[model samples]
Target: MPPAEKTAWDLARAATHANLPLLGTPMSQVVDRLLSARIRQNAFKVRPATRAGVMVSGGGYQGKTETVCEIAAVFEDSWRELHGSHPETVPGSRDLWAPVAYVQTPVTAKPKSTCKAILDFYGAPTKGMDLPELIRQVAASLNDHGTKVLVLDDITRLRMHRADDQDTLDLIRAFMSMHVTLVLVGVDIPGSGLLREGRGRGGKSVNGWEPTQTERRFDLVELDRFRYDTDEQITAWTTHLAGIENALRLLDARPGMLTEGRMPEYLFARTNGVVGLLERLIEDGSTEAIVTGTERLTEPLLDSLPLTLADSVGRDVAAGEVPALPAASRQPGTRPGRRRNTSFDDRGSAASTA
Candidate 1:
């Protein structure tokens, strides 16, 4: 007899399997761009004019958080794999090499708290140091490590009032002036203010180089959920699902049992094209398959499971409807609290919510 068809339980077991690598989605392309730019920047450290940075912005669970880990791993792993020990020299210069430093910006991040996080990351002694002194110490410590890159994740958490945010920006500007390549990742970033045209708080009347300074240092990259109705988006979504199916085959007891077709479409409908939601839906569906002894993930099996969080929003977005803009614009002229923003936090790190 031909082999039995695989059950929902089988796929569920596979979904929960450990060490799953990232599926190659649009976000992967953004990750590549970030790494490539960093490599180029690090390779020509002598040319301060050529020094630059990048910002990765996207909706929540659109892979902003995961991208942080992946980018850090790429920088550190690539260097370590190439050379067995910590780099003794900077990429382009004959200076000591310190690797990339990744820090989660504290919630409502103030300048002092942000600096403290940076200092702690470097193990720099900050005892009794004033803000100015702390900046000097942090810079010196990073310099000693020969650190070439500074990645500030969860940047959305920074307070947006002029006084509060200006301080944080000052710290970041200090790092950029040192020619350190900075990578900022967040979901709340609006394409305005320093991100669009350089203007500080209060409006067009305000003139400052700080916003310009930020724009000059970093280029922008965006990542969001795939759209359900668009053919192009559907192709990408199917492509992602195909990868998962291929991976499942490795553990599949029966060959040709996990073929793809309608499943991905159902998944897109359920997840409304959000990658994170898609993953969660699959996991939940698989778990039920195990519990109920359903053998395979069919339309009925998935429909019986709880709906993904993005179900409604994803569908609307796929149909070309834009969600309400965040109120935290960070643009100089925008009204306070009118600036739309999204939540961001570093994985497994303490945040300064105060």
Candidate 2:
């Protein structure tokens, strides 16, 4: 492990690992949803599989949330690059309201959020303070920023009804009308995975949680874990797994860290190979270490895992029988989220919400 990662892990020992489904779960959905929306740009005029789309998957505790946050950092960096003329204190300072895309935080809307409040966060969404003049403001906002992108991260928590696809689609369109791209990240809708039934049907024809489609007018890009990821992505995952194994070895903690065959098998079984779940497993495994301080985790730790994580980690990500590989070094910014995010508690020990 790199000195930095080691340093992070050290800091994470006290009270770093936990499951904040409230926050992490929603955040995960948002990342995939927004990526799907971005992919839409690729399929303009009913184009092929060109609509922008990106997904991160793997078992518990592997770093999916970390990956998403890393992405946010990318947007933040891009925002900084475009406006070398912004404040030094602000993280991504171009008035914030004038963002290239709209990003919804995991804030609860019990109090209700307005279009005005939403636009304001973007810094300068062309529309300024006068939203009643929506058309005019939208036009100006688009002209100033080009197409906007929106991400309602884990939007399901807002007390909104899932039954109404039209309403959902319209609401999405209303936000999209701001000329920015829109991303609806939510928990991976299970079933078929991410299949699209057709237009108006919210693109949900089974096969998983499909984003709702409006008027058969838009595109689709749902993320899935079954697909192959880049070698770099794989490298990041193994590095995390290796770290967990190393941690277990160091502390000599319980049930026994995953053995050769069981490593990936457990990963697949536990987390469906979703990176978040992989991390979660590590987190739990580590916690067991912290608590018992002596017991070997082994397959016993596998028992406490959530279904999604279990299915993924146990079945998919576990590198059964074969020894896992060493991690390849990574460059800053070049590697997104899970790579740089020290977000997990035990050095961001877990992120199990696949």
> Which has the greatest lDDT?
1
1-354 in candidate 1: lDDT tens per residue?
233445554544565543245776876686677666675457457765535777777765666667666766677766666667544444655434567788887766677788888889877777888888888877776767766677887675544455677677667766776657777877646532435332434222144334455666677777777765555765787778766655542322233222354455456555556666666666666566555756456667766666545443422232122333222112332222233233453467677899
Per-prediction TM-score: 0.70, 0.48
> What would you estimate as the lDDT of candidate 1?
0.61
Please, what are the lDDT tens digits per residue for candidate 2 over residues 148-207?
A: 344444433323333343243344455544435454444432221222322322424453
How does model 2 score by TM-score?
0.48
Q: lDDT at 20 for candidate 2?
A: 27
Candidate 2 segments exceeding 4 Å error: 1-12, 15-69, 86-148, 155-168, 187-219, 226-240, 243-249, 253-259, 301-354
